[model samples]
Target: MTAVQLPELPDLPGKRFPRRVPVRQILCLVPLLLVTVVAVRHRSVLAEGFGQLRTAEWPWLLVAVGATCLTWVAAAFTRQGAVVERLPRRRLLATQFAAGAANHLLPTGLGASAVNLRFMTVCGVPLARSSAALALYLLAEAVGRLGLLAALLVAFPDALRLGTLLPHGAVGPLFAAVGAVLVVAAGVLVFVRRLRTAVCSFLRTALGEARSVHARPARALALWGGSLAFPALQATGLAAVGLALGLPVPPVHMALAYLAATVAVALVPTPGGIGSVEAALIIALVAAGGPAAVATAVVLAYRIITVWLPLLPGALTLGALLRLKVI
Candidate 1:
């Protein structure tokens, strides 16, 4: 009776979506959720305080948003200035959006770098030009960060209470450890002939056999300058958020906290630094003179505007760009 009553199912395209399961996608999200929950718990108190901030001064929020927008604008233009390929401004912006989204989504910061390189290739930019542009951007990021750090040091000499913030007793030692590595690396690059030659060979192989352009000194400097503007603006933007939440913040403190957060999150290697960044930011804010509760609130609002809000638009752009083969 069962066989006699059988009715044929309509044929369908793509084999009825197949029975194969997607395992990597399911796996990909497990770590992200775990990290996000951990980061959130660390800031639970601050997040609770966020509800009260709904009635806080909002003019600063407006300024913060504007500043953040400008930072991305600077980033887009910086890349445009470095590459010889002449994509329209709109395309440059698209590339930045897509790259930023990927920056947060991918592991160990490699996704964004790949997306950036792909953008350059699609635009017919020679390999050297593309690589140099990114390298220029990185140099700028470093310069801006150091400048922020220096400002914080000068402005808050009394507040550089490093020992107070690192209760786990790692931040200070970690800082020293990095410095030690840097010194060793510099010594090798500067004095070791074998290492220097090896580095040159490596650069040549990866950047392709093409001769590096005799870069115009002014242009190269400008490239780095453009790179600095983004982070500088971003720090300012975060400071504006600080002001909005009624945190007692000075520009110097803002710069320092931002710089410290950047450095700290880079070490965590989480996708876009996630919970690690929020914790670093709150700690840095507290060290920079904010009360613990207010520091937490400020960090929450900071994440809201800078990380959470932009994620949606940036992600959509990433999908579009990938679909279009633009990056």
Candidate 2:
């Protein structure tokens, strides 16, 4: 009954166990890193935006900023309205602001959608239901935007000169292109059994959710009202910027121009529609009878207030949310 003894190993000088970083800590840093990269990439734009703000009227600029803030609220409401279950009000609102930053970082609306999807899932929603809710929100938003644009066009037919915005005979080709894409998409959907089945299942789920939402009067109102207000607020922000910068276009005309420009460039895949939005907006304002220089200034200033100014704060919020495991 003898115990075996082993020799003790000497510790090597300057040798230490590597400190492991927590994955959560690393994830939190990811958002901040992304924010830094984005800010550096668009430094010139950010500088120009700040420079343009100097010439803007303080009162109107304040209105633009207010509208920008409210857009996040509207988005939060719309997101809530999409799902039947109630989400925490403050966290939902904060997520929208964070989503705004994410939207600017990713192409089209993917970033915002991703953030919302993650939030919904983290809040205990099923993945399929969250996806349906996201689709419903998008559909409602699109309809609201288009409906508002149509109403404005009817109210002020002369607000925008379509010919100035589009090249000669471009309309026919544009429609044809859209139709071709739709036809191709339809063909694929029809030919692929698995895809068609999946789409049908998704559609059924989305429709069910939509019906459930509409059945609740309060939810329905929030859904539609928020959807409509989101675009209106965005347009108002642009109009306010136009006024602040002394753009010659009327406020209503500027709103109309904003709606038109956004709709036209909705399909462009650029992150937050950055370049395309600026160019489209400038052309839209010019078509709405604004001087080219003033139109450019208005668009730049509007973007500054709406996008660049809040970006850092939004990014910080996103990082905090990640650290807290909110999404």
Candidate No. with top TM-score? 2
TM-score of 1: 0.73
**Alpha-carbon lDDT, every model:** 0.69, 0.93
lDDT digits (tens) for residues 150-183 of candidate 1: 7667867875456555677787898899999999
Reference-based lDDT, residue 306, model 1: 72
**Runs off by more than 4 Å, candidate 2:** 1-21
TM, every model: 0.73, 0.93
- Runs of candidate 1 exceeding 4 Å displacement: 1-53, 84-87, 167-199, 204-214
Worst 10 residues of 1 by lDDT: 206-215
Best by lDDT: 2
How large an RMSD does model 2 have? 2.9
